[model samples]
Target: EQGHEERKSGTLSEPQEFHSGFIRINPDHPDRVLHQDIDNIENIRSFISAARAAAFSKPVIAIKTGKTAAGALAAEIHTGGKQSSDAVYDALFQRAGMLRVSDLTELFAATQTLAMHPKLLKVEQLTILTNGGGPGVMAVDSLLQSSGKLAQLSEETRAALNKVIPQSDMTSNPVDIFGDSVPARYQQALEILLHAKEVKNLLIIHTPSALAPSEDYALIIAQTLDKLPKMARPYVITNFMGEDAAYAARRLCSNYGIPTYRTPEGAVRAFMHLVSYRRNQKHLTQTPESNADDAKINKHAAKALVNEFLAEQQSYLSTHQASQILAHYGVECIQTEVAYTPTEAKEQAIELGFPVALKLISPSIPSKSEVGGVVLNLNDAQEVEQTAFAMLLRIKNTYPDAIIEGFSLQKMAPRAGANELRIAVKTEPNFGPVILLGEAGTGLEFAQAAVALPPLNMNLAKYLIAAAHDKGVLKERVLPEKVDKYRLCALLTRISQLVIDQPDITSLELNPILASNGQFLVLDATMTLSRYQVQSHRKRLSIRPYPIELVKQVTLKNNTLATLRPIKPEDEQAHQEFDQSLSKEDRYKRFFGELPQFNHDQLAKMTQIDYDREMAFIITQDNATLGVSRVLMDPDKIHAEFAIVVRSNCQGLGLGSLLMRAAIEYCQSQSVQFIEGITLPENTGMIELARKLGFKISRDFEEGSINMVLALTPIDKHG
Candidate 1:
């Protein structure tokens, strides 16, 4: 009875009622009878498992209260002791993939946010609008607290907002009106923010004080938001006032598909979560690259280990065995041969290579660096012998009881660029193997890189490499002459695939993945494993040919026509023609104004099409092409870039939009998330056409161009 009443009072009957969905759980139990009726631990576990299965698409959030031991004991009367029950529950919830809320306020905000913006691309990049400075300040503070960024207002956005507000108002971070604003003013501000280039999500904060009536402002705000493209923008309204004002605002906002919260903090957190979820979803849908060789290596090693260990009933392989596995998977480790004596170490160095690194390889002592058992850079036979003797004596003196495996002599790798990277893996109970990439060397512990759970396919591997600071550094700076970025990217991709295929790898460290003197090498490596560990869910790798479908074709005036087909690698010639036709000014606008010379490598990357993420079509008349339109999907395939170039003779024929419309239809048919295009502000014709096509256009001062975004969802079927 106690549990039943609590469930009836707290839980929603139909959690998936809305198109955008959310799952809510209330931890507060008022009825005491429920505590004595059921086995709490067993019941909670069952409920958590069921909820996880039910809310796979929606975000299931659990809100728990009561922290005191007395309360815990009361709960334990039906469940078990506090410690065991809490631990089990925590693990259960985490395993079941439910997001736990710290407070009731957060829970409510999360529910509304999820309900309003269920799709990932619909959230993130928020715009803030407020009437008074006090509320504006509070909104900004709340946004920062929730990790929501203040979007930079575009020039057109500023001009539009200025038309409504006084010239003295701040136009950048927060659009604030000095005095009481009318419905027109609120609507104008919201419109400007919604159409801005930088703003994807919006937060509207208004205080229902004596200055302006709360109900009127709420009605206007709601109406304005409803007019916006359903997939392009999402908004949250906050009313700081009496209960009547809050209720009015919430009702109006909800009616217009805008989420409403009483507090700014809750609204901001909801927006942040929405953006994060969208980013993760994009990562999930990215097409994985093929790394079949790495998979084969892992398969062979796993099979070999199973056969070798079966007779002896051994669970784990030794370092040598693990090294062989890694070598097969393309991980470059040190070249070392076990040496029994100092003379043997000298001979081994001579036999292997010059300038070798000598390290104590003892099965008993796992961490050689901690035990002063490592010696590096021995140039000659005499030096190798001396270093080997010194390392052995130091290790023996440090730990007399430690068993010795012969000295490992490895070739000393040259220093590379400043960036040293580490990719480590640890097994999680439910998420399986979690891969962590970070800065290596002395300050490695401080510079934490990106993390992902396996199966590590091509797309995830690319993301991990891109997520690191090294990739950023490479992008910003000029690479050394003759440096190969593509090769490095490929190597990282191979390493990630290897780790995913080989889960027996407990700890794998590759310090100083160096790019030195136009060459890349793994300077050092150490791998460890748990003897009896078994990976439960092994994901299979597969590759299939890209799918193709015939989309709409367009015909322009003067009989210039184009049959839009899926882009392919063989179309590099057509891609070159489009690139060559671009005027310097047009090229500058498209590439952020840098007139860098293009090479074969650059052209390949720019023109490469992954049908899942990007597509480009050519306009041909009698096999003589006039123009081409390219659509490149953004990182989160939710947004795509539309760039078109036509031959100079065909400029005024409306061919661009025809090609653009074709691209838009293709995007819609493929279920592509969103579409974005950039045109110079001076190109009035293009801007007008974009607006006519229902694209939300914004002019940016920084880029000296107009940005247009079109949401492909709810696509006009006839168009």
Candidate 2:
């Protein structure tokens, strides 16, 4: 309706609309041409913005159609518009903190489930309680298929269940109370599972039976859950089978704030949806450690080499050139030497050592081993020379016009127990630079690889590693010693920072990066260059990265040096301390009420903010936060709300003025039309600061507050 209003008022500029139910944005809709601007890549990101904004306040259950090739074609034909890569859509939805459901059944099931019990589960494990064995078994199967776990009942819990459940075979995880049991039996079984420390989510399944009605069983479960404090125990979900008999029970469960599904699979899928939603939300808010090793990286040298290749109008960098650039970024690369001729290759091999590897270096032949362009384990100079000569001949004959950059010679890597991991970066039109990691060799591995967008921190890198492990892409075998995951995460993070530091590098591939005994050796690599055009270096990312460029050094009024920068996740502790140091009156004035002690989640929400929609600049000296200024833009991006608070101990240091100025400049840069803030009338310092910053101050005597408004952009008269 809001979208309709905007369209009717001639105010709908973007091809997207967000509301309470769900946002349906089709950039390629045929009507978009008449009603919206030119559809571009930004349309997808605009959808991301809408989804994320909605997700912030409520759970967003999304249904992404056209997953298969046939479905995609059908959608294109029906809508008369092409679809972007489904994988890109998947990544965007995950990044935006939206839970994707497969069909309308799962969609409504998940929506109802989340809408009723919005609290996240403590664990992904589901403890099934069923009167029939078949529905319990079905629920178990669905749970495992969804990559979820079945709650393992402890021996003590099983012993307790044996006392109430009559059948011996039903004493396990999916405790069966027997079909002939009464409603009291279900209440007993539910209480047992509800109090079990191992159970995080409980799903009770019931089929129609003459022994007891489904509504009676649902009432008992509801009453049992109500006995405990709200959200104090594992969440209880119900699978009341059959439409005719289960209809009243389902409605009763809905009124009692319990999720009910018609099928066991639906209930389990809804529970797993909540699990996925929780994980995605964690990824959105988790604060990652800063990459401490980036200072040691030779970004300048890497940029220079990439620039040199771009200056020469060459896209592909030679093997040795690529190795050198990787080395500059602190990625351990096997020493490689380029030779113009076979004799030069032999001489280079001799200089390096015996038992070397020789590969044909040509822009056209990307996969050297595929075209007989590579030879391994050459023992002596003669073997190296002969192999190089034969490889050159084979490649030259295969592609007569292919640019042969000569041969690359390097010592052979010890292949015994080492894992060959492929790490590559590719630029997608929608998401920009994406990082791929998986097992090396063959197109099959490429198909199974896990991908993540760049600008990764330690936490995001760990998530990528975990996701790869979950997908069976990268496995850790006990034989060769465990792969150093921390080192690997650091390396991935460095590679992420490399792209941020040097945007000219359009693509990079490190094939068969050997990982053995906590060591990573880049065996063979390739890089492609393009003169990236961007207003800012990080603009290519679909999700905005931390704005390191905004960090600045400033001096306080007391001549003490301080740093004014965007807040980081690492500042949560300091922010807590800053919040606690404020006097009662100061806190009340700042918060407009008595401030409560912030919990971990609240502190995380304050510190780990999205840089795209919100900006929190803090003035810090040493290890303490002296002051903070935060600006939060609304969904429209035209108006922003501002807040500033200086530490009570450091109130007279001119920090508030500095932070407000910085925030105003930031709002101006973002093109925010108006900046608005309010403060108690007693807060004369803040009101004076607002006046100094060119803000129009208006007093509200009824509300006993002062409203400060600053127009960053000229107001339009036509609106």
Q: Judged by lDDT, which candidate is best?
A: 2
Cα deviation of 67 in candidate 2 (Å)? 2.7
Worst 10 residues of 2 by lDDT: 1-10
Each candidate's number of clashing pairs is 3, 0
TM accuracy, model 2: 0.90
Query: Which candidate number would show the highest TM-score if scored against the true structure?
Result: 2
For model 1, how does the per-residue alpha-carbon lDDT over 147-231 read when each residue is reduced to its tens digit?
5567777887777777778764577677786557777777777777777767766677777656567777778876676776766
Question: Candidate 2: lDDT of 420?
Answer: 81
- What is the TM-score of each predicted model, taking all chains together? 0.56, 0.90
lDDT of 1: 0.57
* Cα lDDT computed for each candidate against the true fold: 0.57, 0.77
